[model samples]
Target: MTGARITVDYDAKALDAALSQAVAALDNPIDLMDAIGAVIEEAIDRRFDTASDASGSAWAASLRARQGERGGKTLTDTGRLRASISRAVSGSDVAVGTNVEYAAIHHFGGEIERPARTQVLAFNDAGRFQSRKDSRARRDGVQPIAIATIGATTITMPARPFLEIDTVAEADIADVVQDFLRKSLNT
Candidate 1:
């Protein structure tokens, strides 16, 4: 839980007023925060499943997808990052997201530059070397280079925002507030 997190902070002044009034009427307002946290958690999970952002726009195709890799969803390699998302409710606030080290890079999009520690770096090219130089290699079938060496690199990741309450989620949260207010009045 040391990395980035999505804190539940409403920007709508009207919603803030409504939430304040509604919670003031309740004896235990933390329960309402807990409910809101659950809603956010569900929304984030949905975004992962649909490969969509908080705005409901589809996430940019991952590098693996562009390379013709199959059998896994974007941001879901091994499911560690997705499954790491959780909610923490404290007082009248809730924060939802993951402690994964790479969460911010994938969510916000950025460049990572790795300086060569040694004189050279080595690794298999996995047909990439041939694909770049020879179209024939692509048509015939790429031959995996046993070893390739390079120094330093920059990896760019595109933003795939998944940690905000969108319009739909805002409406849902408003409904939750209204319901809690109604219940408080009833009690």
Candidate 2:
């Protein structure tokens, strides 16, 4: 992938104009999602366009065509959006890490300390069942166990063996974009 950076100076007037346009476009949540998706799609197009010597407008048109081929469905429910964006941006699946741990318990044979640490790998985007794998424990007492992998975006951690495991209930696309922006800016 090309790692070229493009720096365009935005003066106060230009910034104000852009902000005014954005405010004017603000409507509902879905509209916001669509706008954000457009921005993301444009950014991806720009990177490729520069390397290929294609105009920005032409690149955007190509992206729109690609989006249409995929049914022009840019935004969906939070879960679906996560999967879609991950696939679109990375061209690969993305996974979120969830931690699972166990504690000391009283069993039939006196106090029993079960395997102390277990981490459950959960898919960040999908609701369907995926394949699972075992991960190496991060610590001496903690056992790293990952179950169910689905496209690297979603998974389920079985309740068995571990005393407690936390799962992601939702994904925030805005936060994801902010994080991406932060990382991109720093680099």
Candidate 3:
């Protein structure tokens, strides 16, 4: 959020004058939504492509993505995060967000792990990682993962912002908004 411009306030007199001439501008909620969504989407995409996948935070560059043993994208896989990013447009508002559970932790550096090694077993019914539930981890109907209680293990993931705006992104957002308004008015 270092370079993000959160508020845009227009002079009341100037807004009134423009409103009269561009009455049709921003009339449709979808136009406004699309414009806003595009700005956020493109900004995220740029970060993902940059490999750093972040800005604003000094720690952003420290957490480089690591590849898994099987060449899988692992923790830094932007594919899942990219796919999860979404937008919603309502009559009065526009919203952009990511459904990834770890998105917030990645955006802001944090310490993770319970006081104790909660549950190392795979048979937790409601939690995220169900060992038995995974077909690949099951061997002849037996859980492939061993059930054991490990000691406290903490993990520190640095902030890798996929949803922050830099200076260029701020300008891009303004241009997109302006273009959308102009086109909407002309139509």
TM-score to native of every candidate shown? 0.68, 0.17, 0.62
Ranking by TM-score: 1, 3, 2
Winner on TM-score (2 vs 3):
3
Which runs in model 3 stand beyond 4 Å of their true positions?
1-21, 53-75, 114-148
Model 2 lDDT at residue 39: 48
Quality of model 3 by C-alpha lDDT: 0.64
* Candidate 3 per-residue lDDT over residues 101-156, each given as its tens digit: 87898777688985654343354334445563345446434453555556787888
Identify the leading candidate in terms of TM-score: 1
Question: How far off is residue 78 in model 3, in Å?
Answer: 7.3
- How far is each candidate from the true structure, as Cα RMSD in Å? 14.6, 22.7, 11.3
| Selected candidate, larger TM-score, 1 vs 3 | 1
What is each predicted model's overall lDDT from 0 to 1? Answer: 0.76, 0.33, 0.64
Candidate structures ordered by lDDT, highest first: 1, 3, 2
Model 3: worst 10 consecutive residues (lDDT sum):
65-74
Candidate with more favorable, higher TM-score: 1 or 2: 1
